[model samples]
Target: MSKLSLAETAELSMLLEVSANIKPGNIDRFHDYEDTKFRHFLASAVLARDVFERVPQMTLGEAMYAAVEHTNGHTGGNTHFGAFILLLPLIKGKGIAGACEAVLRTTVEDAVRFYQAFGKTQVRVNREDEMDVNDPASITMLREKQMTMLDVMRYSSETDMVAREWTNGFALTRKAADILKEKDGADQIQEMFLRLMAAYPDTFIAKKFGYARAVSVMERAQLVRAGGLSLSRFDEECILGGVNPGSLADICIAGIFTALLEGWQWDC
Candidate 1:
C-alpha cells in the first residue's frame, strides 16, 4: 500500500501540479494571476484535505460540493473546483477503473448538488441552452428531467474537457497517470503537462476564447515540444493573452494523484 493516505495523495497532487514550474498561463511557483496567487492555490489544497478524506463516505455530489465549499473558504477565487470534480470520483473509487465507473453512475441528487457546487466557482464553463449550470432554473430542470450527474457531463462533454473525462471514463487522466509512471523526477510533471497541452485544445481556453484560439494554443504547445518555440516565450504569450489552460491543469492534478496512489514516488 502507499504510505500516503488518500487525502494526503490528493493534497500532494494538487500541490505538485500547482508548484510545477513553466506550466504556461496557469499559476505555478514562478507565476501568478493578479487575483489568484500561488499561495491561494496552496491554501485551497490544504483546506481540501479533510474533504478528500471524507470522500469515500460522501456521495459524489456531496463530496464535490464540500470540496468547493472548503476551498472557497480560504481562497479568494476558485482554485480546485475542477480538480475536485475529477479527483473525488477517483478517490471514492480508489483509482480502480471499474470502481471509478461505478462512482460516476450518479443520481439525480448528484446533479443537483453538483450544480450547487458549480455556483461556488467563478470557473468559466461552456453554457448549455437547456440546462445551463449558471441558470438558477437549471436545478429544477435537472429534477424535472431527472438527469444524473453523468447525464449533465454527457451534455457538456463536447465542449468541456472535465466533462469529457466523466463521459469517457477519464481516459486522459488515466493515460496521464500511466505516462507519469514512465517519467523520473519532478520535472516529469512539467513534461507531462506540456504533452497533454500539445495534444488537446484546452477546453478552458476554448471556453474563454474561441475554438480557433484554443487550437492555436495546442499548435504552440506542439511547437514547444518540437523545439521550435521557446517555453518562456510561449508562457509569456499565454499569460498576456489570458489564455489559461485550466482544464489540463485539473487533469494533471488527478493524473498525479493516480500515479502517487499507484506508488509513483515524488523524487523532488
Candidate 2:
C-alpha cells in the first residue's frame, strides 16, 4: 500500500473518528445529534481536506480559521473546530514533540486569528476570566495583553482538554496514538475512545454539564470498560442526557492521525 500524505491522513482521521460505531455521546455511523448530523460531520471532514493540505502555507491560526470557515460553509455548524485545533498543529509540526514546540512559537497575531476562528463556531468553550472567546472585546484584550496562542492555551489548559494538549506537549494525544498502534481491527477506534473517556474527564462535557457530571460520565465509561456497563446503554444514556465528549473525540482524531502518520494500517 502507498503511504498516505499528511492531508490524506488528517482527513481520514476525521472520517474514521466519526464513522466509528458505538461511540458514546458522539455522532458516529450509528448515531447523530439533532443539529449536527452524521452527514454534517462527513461533509466537514471532506471539506477540511483542502485546509489540511494548505496547512504548510498557513500559520497555525490561519489554518484553524480557514478550517472553521470551510466547515461552516458546508456543515452549517461546528463539527471539526476542535479537531482542527488538534490536527493543525500536528500537521504543521509533523510530530507530537514538534507540534509542542510549534505551539510555543505562536505569536499574538495567532491568538487574534484564533479568536476570529472561535467566533465562527458554536462550540461551547470554557472561557478564561481575562479573554473570553465568546466576547468580541476579548480580541482587544488579547492584543493588549500581547498573549500568544500558547499563552491563551496555558490560560485555558486547566479547564479545556484541547487547550491542555497545546500546553502539555500533546501527552494524552500521543498516548492515544500509542494505544491505536497497539490495538487492531475496526474495534480499535471504539476501544481507544472508551479508554480515553474512562481515564480523562472530558472538559467539553465539563464545560456544558459541570465538572461533577463530567466525572460521572468518566466513571460510567470506566464501568463500560470493565464490563459492568453496556456500551449501547452508555451510548443511549449519553445521547438522552446530551453528554457529548467532543474534546475527547478531537483528541481521538489526532491520535488516529498520528497513528496513520506512523504507518498504522487501515486493515479494518
Candidate 3:
C-alpha cells in the first residue's frame, strides 16, 4: 500500500515529469513554448487533483468541468485539457482498461456536464454545434441517443488520439507502464515518452502538421529508441521540427502517477 494521498499522487506525477528536462516538443525544465510553460503544468496538476479528490461524489462531467475550469482560472490558459480528459476516469483507481469502459458507460447527465465543462476550458477545438451547454436541446439529444462521454469521444476517436484512448482501452498508456519498469529516474520517463511517441505517431503533430509529417516524426522517434539516433540529438530535432507528441505526454503523466501509487522503484 502507498502512503500518498490521491492529490499527492497526482501532484508527484506532475512534479516528477515536468521537472525532467527532456520531453521532446513540450515545455520542461530545459525549454518553454511561448504559450505553455512548465509551471502551468504544475499548476494544472494541482487543480486537477483538487477536483479528483472531491467527496460525496461528483459526476464525471462535474469533475472534469471543475478541474478544467479551475485549471484555466489558475493558469489563464489551456494547459492540460487532454490530460484531464484522459485522466479523470482513472483518478479513483480504475485501471486504464477499466476506465475506458467506464467512460463509455457514463450517463447522459455526464455527457451534458462534459460538454458544459468544455465550455469553461481553453481547449483548442472548434465547438460550434449541439455541444453548447446552454442549449436545452443538447441535453435532450444526449438523452435520446443515450450518448455517454465515451460515445462523444468515439465520434472524435478516428481523428483524435486522446479520444482514441477512451475507445481503445488506454492501450498506449498501459504499454508505457510496462516500459516504465525497465528504465530508471528521468530516463524512465523519457524512454517511455519516446517509445509512446514512436508507437502512436502523435495525432497532435498530425493535426497541426500533416499526417505524413507525423509519421516521419514517429519513424525518427523509433530510430532514436533503437539507438540509430542519439536521444539528445533527436530531442532537439523534434523541437526544431515542431513535432509535439502531447497526447502521449499526457498519458505518460497518468502512467507515472499509477506507477508511483503502486510504489515503483525506478532506480531498481
* CA lDDT of each prediction against the hidden true structure: 0.87, 0.89, 0.73
C-alpha TM-scores of all predictions? 0.95, 0.96, 0.87
Model 1, position 122, has a per-residue lDDT of 84
TM-score between model 2 and native: 0.96
Best by lDDT: 2
Query: Model 1, range 104-204, lDDT digits (tens) per residue?
Result: 67899998999999887887865555676788999999999999988888888998898788878788998788888887677889889999999999988
Model 2 misplacement above 4 A: 127-129
Tens digit per residue, CA lDDT, model 3, 1-268: 4577766766677777777667777777787766677777777777667776771277677777787777787643777778777667766445575576567667777787787777776555534534555666767788889888878888778767877877787776677777886655656887778778778778778777867988998898889878898878887897787677777777887788767655675544
How does residue 129 of candidate 1 score in lDDT?
A: 54
State, as a TM-score between 0 and 1, how close model 1 is to the true structure: 0.95
Using TM-score as the yardstick, the better of models 1 and 2 is 2
Q: Which residue pairs collide in model 1, if any? A: none
Count backbone overlaps in model 1: 0
Pairs of residues clashing in candidate 2: none
TM-score of 3: 0.87
